[model samples]
Target: MNITFLDSSTLHHKNDLDLSPLKQFGDLTLYETSSIEEIATRIADAEIVITNKAVLNKELIEGAKNLKLILSAATGVNQIDLEAAKAHDITVCNVAGYSTPSVAQHAFTFLLNFATSIPKLDSEKQQWPQSPIFTRLDYPAFDLQGKTLGIIGLGAIGKEVAKIAQAFGMNVQALNSSASSAPSGEIPRVNLEALLKTSDVISLHCPLTEETKHLINRESLSMMKSTAFLINTGRGPLINEPDLAEALDKGIIAGAGLDVLSVEPPAEDNPLIHSQHPNLFITPHTAWATIEARHRLLDGLVENIKNYLAGCPSNQVV
Candidate 1:
């Protein structure tokens, strides 16, 4: 069987992560990246295709006559056309929960940065040599203990984050719109308005949908405590970039730490990119790309393929 990975670079560069295990399945063709113009041609004769961020729309799916299976190397399959794949009898599978630990850890990395004023302290390290006292209190750090953490989503990563927060003696709450299956737990559910007003730190783990798009906007920011901090390791579009930049500028909120943006590799003109607010922290969507997580994602894809070939077809979304 012919197998192709359209965007292998999303998982690795410079042969850092192994893809050789896939060689046992079929003839594998790897592309560092594929353009919209090149997708159809590359998958023309492949039976199985794996993509991380490469888009596979209706037209491309219809044209690839030999395409039998599609494996989304990451959890989100938003780039794949589910309806088209189903109509064409192409089995679609996506890896999930593989990056839970990595993402949850990264979210706290941001939270701790704000809580401990690590960035500010590091920036002011040069002034330490001339200090009149033993230690510089230029930026005082706050304790996470007793501070409420309002989580916008209560999925695997969100749950893990809650566990960590509790370990730090934080009180945890989830948004009312969070996962419906949020079971009996230490975390209580609160409405958006309440979460906004009460939380000392708000961390977003929600998916991006019409209801959640721009969920954090002018009105919501206005409701939040002036000292509250926002952390988003989920989807970027969940918060309005311009609104967030304005909030940071006006001190409507204390700060924001973001791992994803509405647009990946955000345009040079993105408001948040240019905000330059000392409190604004942005990581290039790497919250879920740890070496360990990437390996789990790759392993999940191989297992899905192995199952499909065995006629079991695990993790099939369609």
Candidate 2:
């Protein structure tokens, strides 16, 4: 098989990950990155295509005359044209649950930073050395104990977050996306309206869909506690960026710790980019890039291809 990795830079490092497993499959061509115009030409004759964040659009998919399989190097498949793949009878596979722990931990990393004002304390290191008093209560810090944690989506990552919140003595609640039935007894499911109005802390873990896009907007922000904090480790479009910026500026909610944004490498005019809001913390969409998780993703990709070659496919998007 002649396989082409359209954008391997996402999985590449300076002599870090072992590539023997991927190379053994076929004559592999790995491009660190690719241009949209170049993608059609580079993958023209490939039997298999691998992509991390490259857009395998309808035109590109149609141009790959020899294409058979497409293995997405990550969980999200929005970058690929699934309808085109289905029409062409090409099998598409993605790795899932590979970044559960990494993402779950990152949510708290941001949450704790806001909850404890770690950044401000570090910035004022000189104050600690001074002996004006035994303690410097300069910020509004609070304990996680007895606080409410409302999770928007209760999937694997969400469940793990709920467990950690409980360990911190927090009262956990969740909003069922499907609303099919209640989840396990530990975290009682609540409606979006109730979760918005009641929880002291709200974290988003849902996917980006028409209904879920801008899930947190002016109206929803209005329902939150004046001092509550918001955390997001899921899809960026789940919240409207402009509304969030306005919310933070006017103190609509307390603050927001975001690991994802509606736009990556946002433009200069992006509302959240230049805001000096002390409460807004934005990480460059790296909540899922831990070393352990990346390796799991690599291993899972090889396994997905192995299954496809054996005449069976797993993790097919329904």
Candidate 3:
């Protein structure tokens, strides 16, 4: 079998994450990046195609005559045309739970920055050292010990984050999207409105769908406490960028710490990208880019390939 990874650099960089595990497979062709115009030709001879972030549209899916299995290097399959793949009998698998620890850790990495105001304090290097006062209390820092953490999504990542929040002596509650599947005893499930109204911190771990897009807009922002903070490490479109920017500027909420934006490599005019608000902090969408997480993703990818070859498909989305 000829397996092609359209974007290989994302999975393995240098010797950090090796591709030797995949050598057991017949043959592999790797491309660091592929343009929209180059996808069809590059995947033309591939029996199995693997990609991260590259769009596998219906036309490209149809154009690949030998393509049998399509593996998404990430959990989300938004880039692939699932309907078209189903029409052509192509098996699609995505690795999930690979980023649970990474994402959970990153959520706090952002939250802690906000709670401690580390960046703000660190930026005042000269002022802090030259000050007459031994202790620099110029900027305020909050504690996470007794705060309420409301998680919007209750999947693997959200659940992991809840555990960490509990360890910090914080109260963890989740928005109950499923009444029948509410978490037992530990994390109380609340309604969306209630979660928005009462929580000290709100984190989004939900998928971006038509209903969830712009979920944290003006109305929802108004519902949160003025001192509350927002964290998004999930899909970008889950929050309204412009509204979030305005909210930060107007002090609607204390701050926002995001690992995603409404757009990737956001346009220069993107409100969030240009905000530069004292409280808003953003990381370049790397909540799941940890080396250990990448290894797990590769392991799942290999398992999917091996299972498919054995006439048993694993992690099938379609």
Candidate 4:
């Protein structure tokens, strides 16, 4: 079997990952990165194609004459055209639950940074010695205890984040997208309006869909408390960048911490990138790139292919 990895560099950053396990399957061809134009020609004669964040549209999928299986290196499959893969009878599978812990921890990393004002404290450390008191109290900090955390999605990652929030003496709640039945549990589901109005901090973990795209726009931002903070570790399109930038500028909400953007390698003129808000923190979509998480991702990919060869594919998306 011929296996081709279209964008190994996305996962094997700094040559840290070992790709030897993939050798057992067949002749594997690994490309550190593949451009949009290079994908079709590179996978033309391969039986299996693996990609992370590569745009495999209908044209590219149909062009690969020998392609049998498509493996998404990450959990999300938005980059691949599922309708095309299904029409051509190509099997598509993705790795899931591999980055739950890493992403959950990162969400809190942002919340804690905001609550404790860590960056401001570090920047003013030089002035600490001049104070005659035991310690300088120049920056205002808030305790996470007693604060309410509203989560948009209650999947594995959201559940983990809820556990951490409870450990900090904070109340946790999730948005009830489907109101068919009233939820009754530790993390009770509430309507979006209620969540936005009551939560002191909001973290988004839901997948992006037609209904969820730009879910947090001007109207939603206006509903939030003036002192509330926002955190996003899921898909970026969930929030409207222009609206968010304007919100921060006008103090519509307290601040925002984002790990993902509407577009990766965002344009230089992106509103969020140029926002003058001091409370905004943006990480380069690295919440899921921890060393341990990457290893688990790689292991999951290998297991997916192995199962496919055994005639029982795991995590099949199409």
Q: How does candidate 3 score on lDDT?
A: 0.90
For the record, the alpha-carbon RMSD of candidate 2 to the native fold, in angstroms, is 1.7
Quote the positional error of residue 208 for candidate 2 in Å.
Answer: 0.9
Cα lDDT of model 1 by residue, 1-318, tens digit? 899999999998788899999998989999999999999999999999999999999999999999999999988899999999999999999998999999999999999999888888888788899999999887888999999999998889999999999999999999985434446865788889989999999999999999999999999999999999999999989999999999999999999999999999899999999887888999999999889999998899899999999999988898
Clashing pairs in 3: none
RMSD (Å) of each candidate, 1 decimal? 1.7, 1.7, 1.7, 1.4
- For candidate 3, lDDT tens digit of each residue in 1-318? 999999998787776888878778878888888999999999999999999988999999999999999999999898999999999999999998899999999998888887887888888887876888887887878889999999999889999999989888899888985533454686788888889999999999998889899999999999999999999999889998888888899999989889998878888899888877888888988999999999899999999999999999999997
Residues 1-318, candidate 4, lDDT per residue (tens digit)? Answer: 899999999998778989889989999999988999899899999999999988899999999988889999999898899999999999999999999999999999999999999987898888888999987677689999999999998999999999999999999888996533444666788899999999999999999999999999999999999999999999999999999999999999999999999989899989999887878999999999999999999999999999999999999999
Query: Each prediction's TM-score against the native?
Result: 0.97, 0.95, 0.96, 0.96
- C-alpha local distance difference test of each model: 0.93, 0.88, 0.90, 0.93
Q: What residue runs in model 3 are displaced by over 4 Å at the alpha carbon?
A: 177-184
lDDT of 2 at 127: 86
Shift in Å, residue 145, candidate 2: 0.8
Better model by lDDT: candidate 2 vs candidate 4: 4
Where's the lowest-lDDT run of ten residues in candidate 3? 177-186
lDDT of 2 by residue, 1-318 (tens): 898988887885774777668887889898988988889999999998889888999999998999999999999898899999999999999999999999999998887897899898888888887858887788768899999999998899999999999999999999964444564666788888889989999999988889999999999999999888999999889999899989999998989998888887677898888889888898888899888998999898889878888888888762
Misplaced by over 4 Å in model 4 are: 178-184
